[model samples]
Target: MSKYIIIHVFVRIFSNMQENSKDPITQSNEQCSLTMVRRVAAMLDLDSKSFSEGDLLPKGWHFFMLAGETRKSELRSDGFPGLGVPIPDLGLPRLLLGGRTVSYNGDIVIGSVVEKTSFIKSIVEKTTNSGPMAIVTIQHELRPISETSPAIIETQTYILLSASKASNNSEKTLSQPIEAEHQKNIIPDETLIFQYSALGFNSHKIHLDRSYAQNSEGLPDLVVNGGLTTLLLTEYIRTNLGLEITDIKVKHIAPLYCNRPMTLTAKKSETDWKLYVYDNNNDIAVEAEINVK
Candidate 1:
């Protein structure tokens, strides 16, 4: 697909994006430095040895080191990384990825160094179709280590609530009665979880350590990275639809664990496609929309 066509589609998604326009955001930043990008290439199963650090980082690869960590070394029983930043103690224990928006300025080429400045854009207590929840919105801007122009900007929202909170995924369960126009069945394994964790610089033990996940966190299985599921959605559009994705926004609905049958489904709309991923239980794990004009 032509670049111009993708740009037009991105514009439409941006127009309908769920972002609050407010001011005086809490700000802090970290360097996209070190050989981190190299590790990122390994996580993606890409051979960066042949490519230099200054070379433009590939699309969909911009999600590296997005979660800047807290200096403290301890973690809550649920494993929310103690990134020194102050996350509101919403009095909630569990964390779910609500949604995210990646505004692609261009391929983020990490020169000798790069910088990512983040902002606590907003935090709202709201009632969703599911139940009561606290939504935390964080914004990240990526640019050259010494430049002012941004190569990319991402607005990521996290939802904090009780683990036992009700979800409609199980209530409206379907064995995929309607055949999807396009879909991919992927049974993710521990190896994919490990590699993706390595790629995204995610150190959450719930994702890497199976015993810790089940014993400590009280989870049935090792958790899958929300980012990886979102990546699958974009890849489905690219490889299956022959479209270039400039933006991706997703609201995770349920948890997806390893060794389960997970399927990605997409259906066509007027200018975009209704996208989703289903867990082994056949409940929607993620709810999303893709725009490819």
Candidate 2:
């Protein structure tokens, strides 16, 4: 049998298992605490050595990356690749992120416990020239060491990269130019969250463990992850333009914060699409170009 057929069979069996299995409650109303952040951060590879001398990550960022990596792991055990790795079977449900929303309550300090809860919000499937891809949405909530108003809530979109197009450096031939846009929505924040160093399994620290972020990373505060921003931009385009994005490349210019709102801008020139996420302050958080056919 062909590899694609084998992968498709596995995906079918896995999907059936998912449908028959008991649905677990993935969402929580709890506030983010320091302890919870610490545990999750450690698993994600966040540690003390990662911090810079002064500037560092804020609190909410920690919860963001943790939930993302955790979600990836969950999908893998059900028959997919883990985070940062391409999926094996080309026939499996190709998951890709569309966008996310994260609310920030207050700051999480070092040695503090953060209250966190997460849930799967939505899942959708689409057929592309490459194959079938599934979009999975998940939500996460975070709070201060002490319970307070405006707890941070984050929604994330995950895209399971299709295996059919699998190859070393699979994104090489997918490059294109930026499109044009007039009106756009942007989110802004002052102290962007960031990872202190190559601390944890997480190369995306702007999303995890804030202590190192603030004191070590040299960032004003904890910064949001560039990857998350890309996900949001892709999600925005998919919803607004309804285009099948074969590949995307994004470049980060500045950092984003916990509660800040970012704008997503898009335009089309010839056969390519250009998109950007701007911080509320009007700074370019990230820029991306997509090839859609």
Top model number, TM-score:
1
Count of steric clashes across candidates, in order: 3, 68
Off by over 4 Å in 2: 1-22, 26-60, 63-96, 148-150, 166-293
Error at 247, model 1, angstroms: 1.4
Clashing pairs in 1: 69-83, 70-83, 70-84
- lDDT tens string, model 1, 160-221? 77656233232344565536878889888898888877666577776888887777556778
What TM-score number comes out for model 1?
Answer: 0.74
lDDT of prediction 2: 0.47
Give lDDT tens digits, candidate 2, residues 198-256. 22233333245455445434444445655546545655665466765555656655556
Name the 10 consecutive residues with the lowest summed lDDT in model 2: 9-18
Which lDDT value does model 1 have at 176?
52
TM-score of each: 0.74, 0.39
